[model samples]
Target chain A: MYDLRELTEAVRTFNRDRDWEQFHDAKSLLLALVGEVGEVAELLQWQPAATVREDVKAGRLHTRLAEELADVLLYLVMLADETGVDLGPAAAVKLAATAQRYPASKFRGQAPERQ
Target chain B: MYDLRELTEAVRTFNRDRDWEQFHDAKSLLLALVGEVGEVAELLQWQPAATVREDVKAGRLHTRLAEELADVLLYLVMLADETGVDLGPAAAVKLAATAQRYPASKFRGQAPERQ
Candidate 1:
């Protein structure tokens, strides 16, 4: 039920209130987003897919992955806000394009089919 | 102006229409998200911050970064949908926690000061 605009604005206001906008230009935000994304990847690096599933089933993903994802999401919102990219709409448009590019009829039962 | 629910639903329907849901349970989605995140990080890996900005300004980041980011965002929406996590609110809450954790006054003029 939450809106992307609201989330973007909340981050905008938080940054403005703290005068942190100075630190969040498009490039910085992108790099920061990449950094958090790296952290998320690092947690799973070299682990077998089965082990990853076990980590999830054991409730081990709730903390680390959630926090890393939260960080990635936070920086993504901030970056989109600073760069004037409306992520939801941009994503919607991209999804449509992707649907065209990778027609499901041709791509179904493809990769990630649980190996 | 787009809603998170809409984006999530769009991705959900995309998967369902293609019957790709079989490949996208929570664990699968998380792993997919992580894979896209790594792709993003690899683009900027080991490059100095200055080079990153140059890549941004030289119009080098448009295609690769955007596509990677779009993939990341798409997977993120799908994962949140499967897990019942509201990314917008979860991010808002986490951002607030982050604001408190790293007070801008104390952390500003600290990192990503363009140097």
Candidate 2:
């Protein structure tokens, strides 16, 4: 498995080599992240929910979805790096908190009212 | 220093234990990801770009942004798992392709027209 640090280093090198760091302020990175996310949402927008897994697996949506998802991840790494957040640890902490907040014993087979 | 596989496994166990896999079809996960992204965007929306780093560092936006970003990541992981795509490898490949597409020597200091 590729490490998140490797990805962050790759992004850091890419931006540094291209002199692009000046353009990647927090807001700009956030906007770019949002744009990539929009692309992902757009690709998945009109598809029938039941067919989504098959469509993605059959290569119909796989390539594009993978690319868009990659963009999202890269921008996310960049944003986190800029803001001094370590994603892996942050995510771990969040997941633990979420587990406590919605324990399986309580939430099992139950959808949130909002969901 | 946390591993992506660790995060994926945690998500898997959480959903499995909650029997929430039934609710995590690809489209629903994508929509949830988008919604979380929107929350992140909304949190950053009116803030001046210049102070984003400080705001995030000083705890004003840190806690909320971290939670929203983590939700985005968890939903993204769920979506990819449902679709049989491994995010770490996919991102590594995409980053490589992007590096080739925009070589630093050629694109240095030149912003893409669209950006």
Candidate 3:
């Protein structure tokens, strides 16, 4: 139920309940994003990789991730929203551009950095 | 000159040199993305906050970030590229979507997680 669509609805509810439409200004949203990321780091503080990855799958790390992700998406949505970008379609657009650059022949099999 | 466009050109050049298309299957691209992320983490391995921030502004942390970002973009571009989507336009699309959800009223003044 917590998939992307469900989560989006929650965002709408949160928005309606709190009447927070005025404050999610771009700058603020980005700052909030930094804060959520900090929280994510807090979860990993002093923990080993094993613990952190486990936290992700276990849904323990960002107990707030759903909300935080919403926040991030909020920013994304807003940026897309304000700029008239279509959220879902934009991803498709960017990919088309990449096809020209990577050309399939150059990007395959390369390690992360080298490619 | 090392802004997004320049970096993109580098990707093209690298592609031409390696002829790696067959290998960079989606799976490999993602694996490479993860590895690039690891490289960023390694730079911060045991480093203090002061050091990490400095790297970001001073361009040290992901000396590979540009490349890594490109790799991420490569994936993004391909996804967009393949789906008949345009990269630049897609961002605009996503932004328009955010505008409705955040609406600026519900998201302000909230600390990172609270919002």
Candidate 4:
């Protein structure tokens, strides 16, 4: 039940408090988003896919992957907040397009080749 | 103004319509999220950081990166939806912990050394 609007407000407040908004334009935030994401990918690179699930169930998810995931989400939230993009709606719009492009029945369990 | 709750609802409905919910659990979504994130990272790998910003200003941001970002976010949003984690509020909570761990004045403009 958490709202992205609330989190975006929090990010705004957090940046305003530190005068860091100057450092957070759409471009910079995008770069940082990718950087955090790369960190997440790096952690998963060393673990087998099955092991990732096992680690989650074993309460060991936080050893690295979870934190990196958190970082990626944080930057993403911040970027969306800065750009005035309501991610939920933006995502909804994108999904609508995706659904049209890849009808569920056609692409079920299959990866679409990028054109 | 988009609610993560609303986006989560749409994802739930979308999957339910296609019976794709069986494919989306915490573990699988996590893997997919990282995969999308990796795709985002790959696009940025060849471009210098400055070029990324330049690309944005030139109105050419989405030849690859923006879609990849959207993909990463869609998976992330879906993962949070499945896990019952409210991303915005969850982000606020994590930022609080990060703020405590790395005070703004101490870590401003400096990446923290991973411990």
Query: Which candidate has the highest lDDT of all?
Result: 2
Docking class of 4: acceptable
For model 3, what share of native contacts is present? Answer: 0.05
Q: Write the per-residue lDDT of candidate 3 for residues B1-115, one digit (tens) a residue.
A: 2122333344455554556544443334334534533543443456554343344434443334333333333443332222223334333343345556555565554432445
Decreasing DockQ order of the candidates: 2, 1, 4, 3
lDDT of 1 by residue, B23-83 (tens): 7666567678777767766765665764555554446554566666677789888766654
Order candidates by lDDT, high to low.
2, 1, 4, 3
Candidate 1 CA-lDDT value: 0.69
Candidate rank order under TM-score: 2, 1, 4, 3
Would you give me the overall lDDT of model 4? 0.64
Which portions of model 4 miss their true places by more than 4 Å? Answer: A62-65, B19-68, B81-86, B104-115
Runs of candidate 1 exceeding 4 Å displacement: A46-48, A51-54, A57-60, A112-115, B25-68, B82-84, B104-115
DockQ of each: 0.37, 0.72, 0.06, 0.32
TM-score of candidate 4 against the unseen true structure: 0.71
Per-residue alpha-carbon lDDT of model 4 for A1-115, expressed as tens digits?
A: 2676666677676676566777776656767777776665564466565455455434544435546656677788776565444565567667888888878888776655645
lDDT of 1 at B39: 72
Kindly list the interface RMSD, in angstroms, of each predicted candidate in the order they appear. Answer: 3.4, 1.4, 11.9, 3.9
Q: Which candidate is the best by TM-score?
A: 2
Chain A TM-score values for every predicted structure, listed in order: 0.86, 0.94, 0.59, 0.84
DockQ: the better of candidates 2 and 3: 2
TM-scores for the candidates: 0.74, 0.94, 0.41, 0.71
For model 1, the DockQ equals 0.37
* Tens-digit per-residue lDDT, B2-112, candidate 2: 567777888999899999999988788888888888888898888898887788887768878877777888888888888887888888888888889899899999876
